[model samples]
Target: MRITEPYTIFLRRLPSGKSVYYYQFRDEDGKRSPAYSTGTNKIAQARRVCQRLYNEGKFKKSNEILFKTFASGFFDDESDFCKWKEVNGSSLAKSTIASYKRLLENQILPFFGSMKLKKINTDTVKRWIVWCSEKCSAKTSNNAQSVFNIIMKSAKEKKLISEVPSSELAFRKIKKKERELLTVEELNRIYHSPLWGWECARRAFLTCAITGMRIGEITGLQTFEVGDDRLNVEHTLHPKFGLGPTKTRVCRFVPIPKSLGLKRQCGKTWAFEKPTEEKPCRADYIYGKLMLICDSLGIDHKARGITVHSLRNMFISYMRGSSFGETIDLKIKAVVGHADESMTDWYTYWKPEMFPEIYEIQEKLFKEITEV
Candidate 1:
């Protein structure tokens, strides 16, 4: 039996012999919502919830806002959502905001842009998920799904929707591919080669190889942070956000051989500044030089997925497996600023002189590369 005057209530029975109460209510425009769960088995409680929500005008509120219009101001500093996040002490970085905006424009808005927030439901979101799988890689599809959920959750928090559409399905799984890392011989070749005339980028790549600095860290490295035998890492350069905190937001001091010949200045001048300009060189520029060197040396750069980041991977692998760095995994993590909370105490009390093996390892590793 169905009660159809003010609203309709029904019980859906599961195979396990449990019944759930669901309801459908009409809006001001006479549009009925998809059956929403009251999350109770008791019909009396379900009726009270439905009546209370309808009286509060939640049934009519969702009709006025379009998904695209609401999403347009999602991360803007002036938006209520941004203010709410700030008040709660969870403000997102500009780079993260930019990434979310790209996902909205490219993946989300194309399908949901014209749809009403009220009309977005589980089936609709599932269809979008299938579409994303067909169009994007598994990882990228997952990112799109995550961003959409965040938007729906925000809408629900603001009372724009009764509840966020549940994508209860698991995100698509990505098959992990083994990234190609530079070998000792290949590294020696790269170190000795001219790097297609990109001297500064070559230095940056070598720094990452020996000290395990990320390309972004190299881009943001300041002259004052360098010392006679070690460099302090405090910030990283985002392509769009410029200088900001490192990826893990943890600062580290890494030992480097003085033979690397990195010079220190008084203030915050970039250590890897372009010769022609005072600005830090682009990561893409460094990557391009690496690709060019790989080509010139007959290395399978593209087929093997080699890139500038391979330098850091090489460093980590060598340090973790080498005899000198065998028992110092925690120190290795501290040196590279790996994000592990269990090692926080070790990272806190770190000093360059505390780990003499790393200096010896550095000296042996860079001895060939630094020699003329």
Candidate 2:
């Protein structure tokens, strides 16, 4: 049923098969949008709830202010945190939302769920931090604290809490391991190694080394997007987020070495199929594969901090070490899709005509690859 008198209303069925009546209204900016839901399927009940919500100025609250209950509403399908389909909505990457939920369920919610939002303060969170430090890495603990901050901020935004208490209790800095890059010779060994006898892995590994695209980009590359001298580095494929925005939320066109050739479709398929078939290179699989080959070749991965990403670092290292040095430096950044101010904003203007000198260095770099 449609109600288009003072506002617009539509009966929408969620993925869960439950139908809810959603209303569209003009926000402060004078733009029409879906602001909230009626949370019921029966027409008469839905209309009554909608009327009540509107009478209360479209903001509803329960008598009790439990952390668990507020969190549920904050992440409701209509809100931005976990929403995927709303237009002009500020949503986090799906994996991030999932992690927040998981963190709450596993750690934060268990401790704070029954308590009121105002009752959770820095001291309460510090206890959780201490507990997390005993079991998790600095990175993971930091993630939980971040989610906690978001919950507090959201509570304040929704008028659930009068103020956020000690909200600056961000976790301590995390000391990340240095990523050791692979030398040209070491990279060449893996390039030549028959360990990646499978065509998909072989093509994918070579692509990563030469172009320096992220694993997400490499796995998301399509046949139509590959060109003679460039690649449309547009999308990323995350296991949890599925296909969404690139890491930078901007599209980049990366230059490739002419010598780094693909069989028309380097990274087209979404996932792995039979081992013999052409499929998108899985990041975790490639990480393990690189480690396996390194072990077999007597290369010290842990000591060197070498991983699949090291190939991208290797490409950057090659560019920095090349004779073209002072000149074509921005070109190098543009070639690798780096967000460098020295180059064009879109990084799309680097035709071979603009920097003919970089092609020679790229050729020399690619010459080191002993393709499988």
Candidate 3:
């Protein structure tokens, strides 16, 4: 049926004696199409449902339509929305920007990128979801939709459209993957094991496992940021993005409980300095190289959930001491930098000397309760 064709609606009484709404329309062959249920008892919502369906269905196109009048940009790479933020001296994370570009290149562009902004609505989104379903898993398709939603939401913010196209959109269920953490013994086994030839990588991993700092924080750590019994997560570095903000987009301190004695006092200032040379490695480097050591240790990284970041998982699991409530009782949040501590405090009263006192009880609790 041509989407632009006129549609008519009527009410039908169900066996339960409740009335429901449905819409009927004509097809391209001048044939009457079957009545489609709007699935709502409310007439207003039902009309919205019918309108949304019409917006998404196959429709006639005009070759005379101007492309420039449709949308200022089509794909993620073309958006140039980053320029808006760059002018403000701040920009969205490169990882998020990359995800948008990847989603557009891989899936979103094929279905909706070329379509006019006026043509993109909930109904077309449903068709796009179904189209993505043909090639990828439900989760990946949903991720693509999320990326599309972000782009549309950006357009809405810029006043390109009256509203976000997918504001009312809902996606199919996404199955969760099972993620397991290593036990304390398994952690020790890996920590003490040979570095499979690279020295700093193992130490970097073990520091994350014991202290619960993110891998990026550990890899990009400067020796000055290391203390007698705590590691400072002041910055993180990425391969493509270069040295940048942490996942939380702020500097934080992660406790290095005296139990591990992760001393970074050495020739180089940065932790895990160039593994083969004398320069510090980026966060991505640590994430990329660990699988080789995993192979050497005869560990199946995927089966074991043993990425460099999973070392933080191991730290978290061991910190809780087999009880969920202990996480709060032990104040594990502050130790792991999960505390809602203000970044403003950095300017207010940030002293590396003051942390040892502020975290005094945490240090004792960590050494007392930590499994390893």
For lDDT, the strongest prediction is 1
Task: Write candidate 2's Cα lDDT for 77-165 as tens digits.
Answer: 55544553355555566665677778877767777778767677778778878888887888887887777777788778767677676
Rate residue 71 of model 1 by lDDT: 82
Q: Report every candidate's CA lDDT.
A: 0.80, 0.69, 0.63
List candidate 1 segments past 4 Å from native: 1-60, 84-90, 166-169, 195-198, 264-268, 324-326, 340-349
Models sorted by lDDT, best on top: 1, 2, 3
> Model 1: what TM-score?
0.74
Report the lDDT tens digits of candidate 3 across residue range 56-126.
44211222122232222433332346665667765667775776667777887777656676667777888
Which of 2 and 3 is the better model by lDDT?
A: 2
User: Alpha-carbon error at 103 in model 3, in Å?
Assistant: 1.4
Which regions of candidate 3 deviate over 4 angstroms?
Answer: 1-80, 87-90, 137-139, 157-160, 263-267, 282-298, 322-372
- Those runs of model 2 whose alpha carbons end farther than 4 Å from true positions after fitting are 1-36, 39-63, 83-85, 263-278, 321-360
Give the TM-score comparing model 2 with the true structure, all chains together.
0.73
Cα TM-score per model? 0.74, 0.73, 0.65
Across residues 47-140, which tens digit of lDDT does each residue of candidate 1 receive? 9878866664556647666788678667777555677777996677678778888899999999899888999899998899898888889998
